[model samples]
Target: MYLTKAKDYLLLCKTIFSFLAGNSSNLISQREMERFMYLICLIFLSDADTTEDVTVVYGIEGKPISINCSYNLKENQWREKSWCKHISETKCQHVVSARRFWMPFLKRRNGTTAIADNIYEGILTVTINPLKKKDAGLYQCKTDFLGVVNTLQKVKVNVLTDLWETEAPEEPRVEQSISSTPSDTETKLHIIVAGLLGFKFLIAVLILIIARSLKNRTTEDGYRRENEHQLFPVTGNGYYS
Candidate 1:
């Protein structure tokens, strides 16, 4: 039984060591390797504590922002959790803690910052309200487990001063419909007016021609009667004189 227990313990330690070695080998950045080593030591040794730096986060100025930190506890029991601002590579300023008093500088708040933790899910969230340009900096979330302080994650927040603006396209103007040809009703009315004027002109010309013909016939008849009277003298009683 003693041999079996010893073998199991050795196996567990081997697994952990292999995992740490594999992770360290995969890291390309020297800073990342250093952070990995720090975390490994914090986990293996009681007196050592370290923070693992994470990805950078971006936020627009005057906006609310939330940063998430996730970690695996690996069966270790955590007694406390904290959120801090990175002062330097090897130092941090504690802002809030799960089981401790808030830092003196953070005691008075304008409802601008908060932190929450989920022990079961191993997630820590830091929130900032109305984020300003001054809030752009490095931050860390840490946990105290097995009498050792270990960094869950670190983040660099960058607050942008310029907010994106989208201009809506101008609405297209509606053009009034134009027609080159007249409507059916107007065209018909115009044709009728032209026909009426042409009929009136034709009637006037016919009337003038008939009147001239009648005047010429009347003059000829009078001249013939005068010639007959000059050619033969007619008695006053209806005979030629």
Candidate 2:
């Protein structure tokens, strides 16, 4: 009972508000109402991620343009309390959905850079460079209310030419080359020669040391044996005398 009455009251309020939005010559003063209007535009753009369908037809070289929008619902079709509370972060879905279109809009201007005053008076405006090829796409303005939804209008942007597009080069063709260059072969040969020389030098030194050691051992053994024989005279019976 209470829920039904509250729904009735909201529907009445929306109808009255829609009239004011369209017919009232005075600008809305209340911050809440203005915010509500902003939310209405957001709902329309909830599905738009970019400004591709929305075109900036007029603007000064540096000044930004604005895109404004409004929407309404039927009295019988009003939903109960499903507005801002259900939406996250000041109704981010609308902004999130609008991103795809917004990206090209920025790139057309300066690529991922935020433009000042891109939104105004229910109208979203942006500055464009008109020279970027990626700027060319479709744009649309949409409006909706609880029960009534509308795709209000759209604009198309066309880029005549861009430096990026014009200056692009053809893909290169690289052929694998095989070569036995003199410098590289010479380096390898020199390394091999040096290694062989080092090995020969090491072998020569080892051989000399081993031979000298064996010769000294042999000479010492011979002298020791001779000294033994001299100290003890060997008789014919094999006894030392």
Candidate 3:
């Protein structure tokens, strides 16, 4: 019985140790993965200068906007370059390609997107005329060097309406001033009412005190007269006994 108990205790301890070991391994893996991701982000940020991914273009609705994507291709070997709009977190839709002229659909849409490449200057320019609200999205410019994807940059395009341009900004301040006057007046009125009620209460308390004093004096005088009559009963008419 003693041996069996020892074996069972050992088994329980072993199982607990195994669980702890597995948990430790998982924590280590998680830490390593986090470190790896941090390194990758650092690399991406460091390469932003070369890739020109830091530019965010803003445009107003019914206006025009241009995005400049500069690249550093070795030996001026710019094999291909493409512009795409981000559809989801992990997917993008190709809008136009500078290397090929096969995007007839984009051309049909009033040729709103015009991509120009300056091979000598290593610059790619994308212009969108008459920008609409639907043009607001995340765009990416990717370069292919020697048939391999090399440099990639992303730019976010924000299209805002001109509603604020025509509205009166001072109207809100005027309304605020008007709204605040009533509250101040109400506060003063409350204070005045409270003071009047307190004055009335003081006057009532003074009246009650004066009435109590008069009643006490009258009672004292009546008691004195009764005592005198009891001590010296009236002898025949007004003679003292």
Candidate 4:
């Protein structure tokens, strides 16, 4: 519920992961480096339904879940906007069971849910006060697109029973990846920096070798000229006829 009210944990982690990659891309000197960074990013992103374009969210079982989502339901997509309760940080837990569709109007089964919340009567009083607040704007624009005259009423309903758990128990992979990313990124950065420094050192050594070779050649030529001058000297004291 906290995660739902604030921000999705999985999405927040993915945002940070992408931000790191986008900003740090300038330092990537190799294909292997970019691949490795994206692989780390995938660890944070792949667990969700990106392949199928499905979004996983979180909320409570009843009392209008505090969330309204547009997604495919029952494989038929009869209901595009699913009234979901985000029980877990990243998983939509309960789904309302509506056997009928395209009715002129819907009956409130458990406040926000038109149907599906049933069987549990114990939580009724506990949820009565917030029920109005939760289901306030649900049907505000119902007539806007449904092409039908419908109005969201403030008629109070019973508390919702913990209905069908739509999503399976998924391991929190995002938590694992987020907790360990800092150390992994730092270590990889160190390795890349060291490789870059070693390359610079190699270039410096080549330049020194070339400079020394040129200096030695100039010194040898000067020595040879001095030896030639000493070996064949013209006698200043003797005159040539």
Candidate 2's C-alpha runs over 4 A off are 1-182
lDDT of 1: 0.63
Q: What TM value does model 1 have?
A: 0.40
Off by over 4 Å in 4: 1-182, 234-241
Ranking of candidates on TM-score, top first = 3, 1, 4, 2
Candidate 3 similarity to native, TM-score: 0.41
Q: What is the descending lDDT order? A: 3, 1, 2, 4
Error of 2 at 172 (Å): 26
lDDT of model 4 at residue 211? 99
In the range 3-80, model 4's lDDT, one tens digit per residue, is 531226445644554565566654453333444543453344434322332332222334333322222223323422
lDDT of each: 0.63, 0.42, 0.63, 0.40
Residue-wise lDDT of candidate 1 within 118-159, one digit each (tens)? 556666667888898878888888887667878777777766
Better lDDT candidate (3, 4) = 3
Q: Write the per-residue lDDT of candidate 3 for residues 1-241, one digit (tens) a residue.
A: 2323323533444454445445664324333343344334333333332334445555657877877877774643345777888899788787877743343213222268877666666777788998888998888888766677644578877674543233325444444343434454576577789889999999999999999999999999999999999998888878878
Location of the lowest summed lDDT over 10 successive residues in candidate 1? 42-51
lDDT of 2 by residue, 181-215 (tens): 55644765777898899999999999999999999
What's the TM for model 2?
Answer: 0.25
